[model samples]
Target: MTTPSQDRPTPQDRPTPQDRLTPDELRTLFLFEALSPEQLDWLAERGRVERREAGEVVYREGEPATCFFILLSGALSLNRVLHGDDVEVTRTDQRGVYSGATRAYLGDRVEQLYPHTLRAVSDAEFFVLPADEFAYAVRTWFPMALHLLEGLFFGTRAANAIVNERERLLALASLSAGLTHELNNPAAAALRATAGLRGRVTGMRHKLAMIADGRLDGAGLHRLVALQDDAVQRAATGVSMTAMETADAEDTVSDWLDERGLAGAWDLAPSLVAAGIGVSWLADAARTVGAEHFEAAVRWITYTIDTELMMGEIDDSVERISELVGAARQYSQLDRTPLQIVDVHDLLDATLTMLQARIPDGVRVVREYDRDLPSIPAYGAELNQVWTNLIVNALDAMPDGGTLTLRTWREDDRLMVEIADTGVGIAKDVRPRIFEPFFTTKQVGEGTGLGLDISYRIVVNKHHGDLRVTSRPGDTRFQVCLPIEQTAEATETAESGETTEAGGAAEASEDG
Candidate 1:
C-alpha cells in the first residue's frame, strides 16, 4: 500500500477542474464505498477528474505532494531510482488505488515529497483532490484511524533512530577493543626496552673503565677501539642467516672462544652470531686487542653490542607504535573532514590494520586492490566502517582458519569492493533473510544483525550504490559497488558536509 503525504500548502487560488465526478460516481470506488453519503459528497465536490495518454508522465518522485490521486481508469507504474537507474517497483490498474497525498493526515510532519515516480502505462484517468483538502477529509472523517496511523508512523521512526544509534555504538566498541589490543604489545615492548637500556648504559661505563684505564699501551688501546668499532658495525648489519646457519655460526664462535682460553665467553656467542659475527671476526678482535687485553676488550665490546641491541629494540618498538597510531587515525578519520575524496585502498588497509589483533593466525588476508582505481568522493569514516563490517564478517565465517580476500576493481561507472572468505557458506534456506534487521544465524547476543541492513542503507540509500553477494561451500564474496561519479543531489550533500545514514552489513542485497 502507498503511504500518504500530509502536506501543508498555504491557501491560494487553484485552477478549476474541467470535469468533476458526482458523489454517486465517487461511491463506486472502494475507498469511498464505506463513507457516508455526506462524506462522499464532500470528496466529490473537492476532487477533479484528470486524464493522461499512454506512456505519459503522471508524477515524478521528490516533487511536492500538492494533490492526492485515485486511479479511475488505465494503469500506472511506480519506480524509484537506484544505482543511477530507474527501477520499477510496482504497477497497478485497480480502480480504488491511491498515491501522492495518501499521507495527508500526517499534515506538515514531513516534507510532502512523492517517494516514487508514477508513469502511465496506458490511458489513465485520476480523481485528484488538493493535498490540504485530502488531509482535512482524513483527519475530520477518520479521527480515530488518523491517530492510530500517527502512532504507528512516529513509533517506527523512534525505533529506527534507537536502532541506528545502537548499531553505531556496537560497531565502535568492537573496533576500539581490537585497536587497543593491537596497540598494547608495541607499547609494552618499548617500555621494557627503555628499562633495559638504562641498566646497559650504566654497566657499559664500568666495562669501558676496566678496558680504558691502565690495562693497555697507547697502540693497544687504539687497537681495542678499532675492534669495538668493528663489532658495532657488524651489529648494524642485520643477520640474514637461516636458523640452521645461525646455530652453526654460534657453535663455531663458541668453540673458537673456548680454544682461545676465553672459556667464559659462551654467553656472548648468540648475540655476536646474531650480529653477523663468526670465528673470523673474533680472531681479528683477538689479534688486534693482544692477548693481555683481549678478555677485557671482549667484555667491553659485548657491553656495546648489548646497548646497541637494546636501542634497536626500542627504535623498532616505537616505530611499531607509531604505525599503529597512524592506522588508528586513518581508520577513525577523526582528524580529517568527514566528506572528501578518498582512495578505497587506504580505507581498506586502515581497517585491516585496526582489526589485525582480532584476526586469527590461521586466517590469512589477501588484498587484491586495483591501485589504478581513482579516488572517489565519500564519507571516509563511514566507508571505513563498511570495510570493517565486511572484513569482520569474513573473518568470523572462517572458524578453523581460511583465506580472506579483499578485491577492488572498476565496473563501468562504478567501483566495486569485494570481501570474500573461504569458510562454511551461508545456507540457501537462510540467505534471503540475511539482510533483514535483527536477522542472524548467530546465537543471541553475538550479533545485532543490523550490519547488512545498515550497510544497505548507507550504500544504496545514502550513497546511491549497490551491494551483491555470491556464496558456495568454500568461498563467499560480498561485492559493494559505488558510483564512480556522484549524483547531483549527492554531490551537493557532500559539498555541504551533510550526513544521513551509515554503513551496515547483514546479508547480500536483492541486486545479487
Candidate 2:
C-alpha cells in the first residue's frame, strides 16, 4: 500500500500541460484568459495537483504559503480564525478561481498578510500555481485581470458608502437631539399654563352656577356680576383694572404679588389708585358678594393672572419667531442684489442686530466706524452673509463671554473691516483648514462647516476682496478689505465715453 505522500505526484515528476495546446490556441487563450503556451508549459512542469478529502484542511491558519492554489473541482472554503471563532470569508467551487491571482495586486502589503486558512468541504482537486507565476499570468491577461479588479473596486466602494451613510445618520440624530432640547422649554411652559387656565375657568363656572341658583340676593348678585365684568375687561385690555375694578383687582393682585414677594407691586399701586380704584370698592364688593362670590372673584382674578402670563409667553413666542425669520433673512441675504452700493457699517449693524440673541449675557460689542468711508460697490447680501458668519463664530468661541470689537477704516482708498474677538483662539494646526469647505472644529451638529467657506467666497470672489485671519490663543481677528474704486478698465471706459461725447459736440459746432 502506498502512503498518501507517495501517491501524490511531486512538482518535478509532473507532465507539462503547456505542450498540449498549439500556438494559435495559446494566443487566443492569452487574450481571453492570460494563459500562454510557454507559461502553461512552465506551470504544467512545476505545478502540483493536490486532492483534499472531505473534512480535510488544505492549509492551516498561520502556515507559510509555498504556492497559490485554484479550485479545479468540488468546493473549497476560506476562513479566518478571529478571536477563537472560525469566520468563513468565502467559498469557491468548480469554474471559480482562487490563488495569488486574486491578491497579486496587493502583494506584500500589510493588509494582504498570509495563510488565510483553506479547507475542502468535499473531495476536491486544486491546481497549485506559484505566486510569481500567478502574478505574471494576471499581468499578461488583461481581460481576466480587469474582471477581477472590477469586483474588488465595487466591493470597496460599497463598503465606503455604508460607512458614509452611518456617519450621516449619526449627524442627523445629533441635530434632532439639539432641536428637541431647544424646543422643550417653551413647549413645557405653555402646556403647564394651559392646564392651570383650565382649572381656573372651571372654578369660575362653579361660582356662576351658585349665583344663578338665587342663593345670593340682589346686592350680592350685582356685586358678583360686576366682578365678572371687571375681570373680562382686565383680561382683554391687559391693564390690571379700571378705577372701580382697581379696588377689586388691587386686593387680588396685591395679595398675589406679596405672596410671590415681587418687587414694584407698590410702584404699580399708585398708578392703579390714580386710575380711580380705591380700597372701598374691593371691600364693599367682597362684603355684598359673600364668601362664595368672593371665591368666584378670586377665580376670575386667577384667570386674569394666568391669561396675562400666557399672553406674555405668546408675545415671547412671537419675538422668537421674528428672530428666526430675521436670522434666516440675514443668512440668505434676501432682497439684496449681487452687486450694489452698500454701507459696510449698516450691513455690520444689521447683522449684529440679528445675532443679538446669540451674544453672551455679559458680553458687550464696541464698534469703531470710519464715518467718511465711501459706499462700496459689492454684493450686499453676500457681504452680509460674511458678516453674520464671522460674528456668530466669534460669539461661539467666547463661551465665558468677552467683548467683541468691530473696526472699520480706509487703507489707501480700500475699505477694511476688522472683527476681533476676545475668545479662546484657534489652535495652530486648525487655523490652516478653517476656511476649507466642510472643515470644522465645532462639535458635530453644532455647525455645518460651510460658514467660513461661503464667507470666503463672498469676500474674495464675489466682491473682489481679501479675507484674512490673525490669531493667538485668546485673541483672533478677521480682516476683510475691499477696493473702493472700480477697476482701471472700468474707469478708462467712463473717461473714453466722456471724451467721445465732447468730441462729437465740437465737430457738430464746426459743421454749423
Candidate 3:
C-alpha cells in the first residue's frame, strides 16, 4: 500500500498509467463484490484508477459521457446546471457510489451526454471504465435488469408527454368555453345598442327638420347644436351614482318637465339627468324656441343626448370585447415564444381574467404584487398553466365564498409568486400527496389530480425552481420560487421532463 500526499500532488507524484487496479482490488468495491472472478478479471483489465484533486471536475454536464465512474476515496459532489447556477444535488464520501455514463446502454437511441457535473470536494480516486466497455458488460451480464429499466424509462417518458398534453387540452377546452360565454354577453349588448342607435339617429333627423322649419330662426338652431356638444361631453364623462341618488335626480328632472307641460317627461327624465341636463337647460330651450315649439326643441335635445349615451354603451361593449380577447391571448401565450422573460403579475392577471366567468359572485379576488420585482426567465406558456391550476384550486377551495389572493415578491436570488385562499385547507395527511400524479381530494371526474402535479413539474423541473405549500383552515398558500435568469442548459431537459432531483444519496439500485 502507498500513502498518498495530503496536499495537491505534484507532476512527479501523480499516479502513472501503468498503475492499475487488480481483480482483488476491484472486488473490494461493493459495486463489484458480487461479480464472478472472470467478470472481475474483465473489469480489472479494462478499468483504470484515476485521481483528482479537491475541486477538480471529473466531467461537466452536457459533455460527451465517455466514461462510467465509481468513487474509491474522498468526497464528491453531483451538480446540475439550473437557472444559471450549479445547484449541488448530492455530496457524499461513500465508497462505491457511481455516476456518469449511467445511460450509455441506450447508445445512439438517446443523447449520451453526462447528465450531471461531478466534482471532487476533496482529493478523490475513482475506478473508471470507458462508456462502450461498460455498456457491453451491463448488456452481457445483466440483460434482464437492463431490459426492465429501459422499459420503465421509456414508458414513463411516453406517459408523461401524453398525459401532459391531455392536461393542457382539458384546460384549454374549459377556458375556451368560458371565454365564449363572456364574449357573447357584450357582443349581444353592442348589437342591441347599435340597433337602438340607428332609430335614435332617424328620430333626431326628423326633430331637426321640425326645429329648422320657418318656426325657428338660424340663431335658435345654432344654440341647440351648441348645447348638443355639451350634452355629448357630459354623457361621455358621466359619473356613476348609487341607486337612490340616481332616482332622486330623475325625480327632480321629471318635476321640472311636468311643470312645463311636456309629454313623456318621466320617460325622458332619466336620459336627461344622465346627460347632466337640468331645469336650467330646459328653461333655456323654452326661451329660445317659445312655448309652442319649446316641446320640439326639448325633444330634439333629448334625442341628441340619448344618441350620445347609446354610442357610449356601444363603445363600452367593444372595449369589453377587446379586453377579453387580450386576456385570452395573454393566458394562451399563443403568439409568444415558449420560453421568455415574463412578468408574474401579468400572467396572474391574464389567468384571473380567463377564469372570471367561473369565479363565484360572492368570492373576491385580490392582487398584492410587488411592482419592483423584476421579470423571470421561464417557459411562459407552461407557467401560465401553473397559474391557472393554482387559481382554479384556490377557487375550488372556497366554494362557500372567500378571498383569493395572488401575491408576488422577490426572495433573495429567486422571485416568488404566492396564491392564497381563505377556505377549508388541505388536511395534514393529504398535503404530502397533493403533488403526486393522479392524487386529489376532489371527487371522481371533477378533477384530473394532475393539476398540481403538472404545476410542480413546470415550476421545478422545467424552470429549476421550488414549489411549496402551507395550509390551515381559512389560509392556504402555494408559493412558487423561480430564478430570475436561466442558464444556457437550463431547459435542456425541459421538454423531456428528465431533470434530476436534489437528494441525499444515489441509492443502491441504479434505476431507483
Candidate 4:
C-alpha cells in the first residue's frame, strides 16, 4: 500500500498458550497435510498465531522477510508497489492461503524480502513460523522438494535470462534492418537528384552564353527571365493530370516542338507538359526572343524547367530523409529525458515509421487518432517499445494481407490506444494463458511468448496502466489504457522480475 489506511501495528504481537496449533490442528493446513506427525509437531512447537486488526499491514513489500504466514481468519489483500503507488494483486479471506516469506526454503541463496505488501482488509489471523525454522524444517523434511524447487527456480531464471537476451538481439537486428532500409530509399533518391541537378545547371550556363552572344537585346533577356519565373510558378501550382490527359498533351506539345525545328522534342515535351507548360507558352517565348534567337530561348527555357523539376525532386527527397531521421529519433528517444508528457499519436506515428520497411504493400496501415486527446506523462521510449511490439504483433498476425488500424482516443480519465488488425484471431483455449510467461500457442523458436507478458509489466506494473485484447475471425484489437492524471512520481525505474536494470524494461526491451 502506498498510503497506509491506519497505523501499522508493531511486530510485538505474540501468541498466548491457546494461540499455538497442535500437531492435529496443524494437519488441517494444506501445506502440512501430508507431513508426518513428528514433522507437524516440530512446526506446532515453534509456530504461533498472530492477529492484525482491519486496515493494519501484516508486512510491507521489500522488507526483509522474517516469517512464513498462513491465513487463519478474516480477509487480506496483496498489493505491489510501482511508481510508489499500490497495485492490488488480490484480496481473499481463504483459510490456509499462504503469504509472507514464500521463498524462505531457499535460505540465504537469494534475498529474503517480501514480494508484496500484505494488509488486513478485516480483522485477520495468521499461523506464523520464523524464517530460519521454516527453512530448516523444509530442508530436512522435504529434501526432494527442496532440490526440485531449487532447480525449478534457478533453471527458469537462467532460461529466461538467456532466452530474453537472444530475443533482444534478434529484435534489435530486425529493427536496425527495417530502419536502414527505410532510410536508404530517400537517401539514394536525394543522391540521384543531386547528380542530375549538377548536369542541368551546367547545360543552362552554356545556353545562357549562347543566347546572350550579342544577338539578343536586354528586353529579350528580361523576357526570358520572366518566362522562367512563370514556368516555376506553374510547376508548383500545376493541377495533376490523368494518364490519358498527360499523354495527349505531351503528344500535342511534341508535334508543336517538331514543327519549330527544336531538337529533343520528344524528350523536352514531357518536361514542358509535366510543368503544365503547353505550346502557347512556347510560342510566347518565341515571339519574345524572335526567330533569330528562338532555338537558344527554347533550349534555355527547357533547361530552366528541367532544373526546377529536378530541384523540386531533390527537395522532396531531402525532406523525406529528414522525416525518417526525425521519426527514428522520436522512436529511440535518444538524448531525451526518460519520462515526459507525450502525445500518444507521436509515439504511434514514429513506431509506424520505423516499421515501414517491414510492412508489405498488401498490408495497409490506417491511423484514427483523436487529435484532441490530452498528453500523458510516460517513459517515452519505453512506450514507443510498447507500440512497436503491439503493431509488429498485429502485422505478424496478418500474414496473407490485411488492414492494421491504429486508433487512439480518450475514455474518462484514461487515454486508450487500440492496435487492431484483420487477421485470424487468437484461439479461445489459448486466450487465458496469453499473459503467462513463456506460454505460447505458436511453434517453438517462432515465439518466446514473452511479448504480452513484458508488455503487461511495462503498462500495468511500470505505468500503472491497463492492456487488454478483444478478438474475432476478422478482427483483433489490443488496447492499452493509460491514466491521463498521473499521480505517481515523474521518474520511475523499471525493475520488476526478469528486468534487473534501467534502460531494460522487460520484454525484449519491448523490441518484440
Tens-digit per-residue lDDT, 72-114, candidate 4: 8998888776434476767888788887766778778777877
Per-candidate Cα lDDT values, in order, are: 0.78, 0.59, 0.81, 0.79
lDDT of 2 by residue, 1-512 (tens): 11122232444545345423333433332222444455555455555567789779877654555566656678877665432337675675643355432444444541232435778888987766666545455555455644666455555445434543453454335434434444555566666767766775676577666657877788766666676566455545555546676666666656644554445555444433433334555466567666555545544544544555565666665565555455445434566665567788878876676565557787889999999999987766667667867887888888888989999999886789999999999899999779765578889877766667657655654455667899987789999888786453322211000000121010110000
Better of 2 and 4 by TM-score: 4
Top-scoring candidate (lDDT): 3
**Per-residue lDDT of candidate 1, residues 237-301 (tens digit):** 86798889888888888888888788576787887886777777777887787787777777778
Clashes of 2: 2
Give the residue spans of candidate 3 off by over 4 A: 1-100, 114-130, 339-341, 375-378, 427-438, 491-493, 499-512
Report the alpha-carbon TM-score of model 3 versus the true structure.
0.79
Instruction: List candidate 4 segments past 4 Å from native.
Output: 1-14, 50-67, 71-96, 106-126, 139-148, 487-493, 498-512
**What is candidate 3's lDDT per residue for 334-408, written digit by digit as tens?**
899888888888888888888988899989998899999988777877888999999999999999999999999
The Cα RMSD in angstroms, rounded to one decimal, for candidate 3 relative to the true structure is 6.7
484, model 1: CA deviation in Å?
Answer: 3.0
Scored by lDDT, model 3 comes in at: 0.81
**Clashes, model 4:** 0
- Each candidate: RMSD: 5.4, 25.0, 6.7, 6.9
Compute each candidate's TM-score over C-alphas.
0.86, 0.42, 0.79, 0.84
What TM-score does candidate 2 get on C-alpha atoms?
A: 0.42
Total backbone clashes of model 1? 12
The local lDDT score (0 to 100) that residue 490 gets in candidate 2 is 26
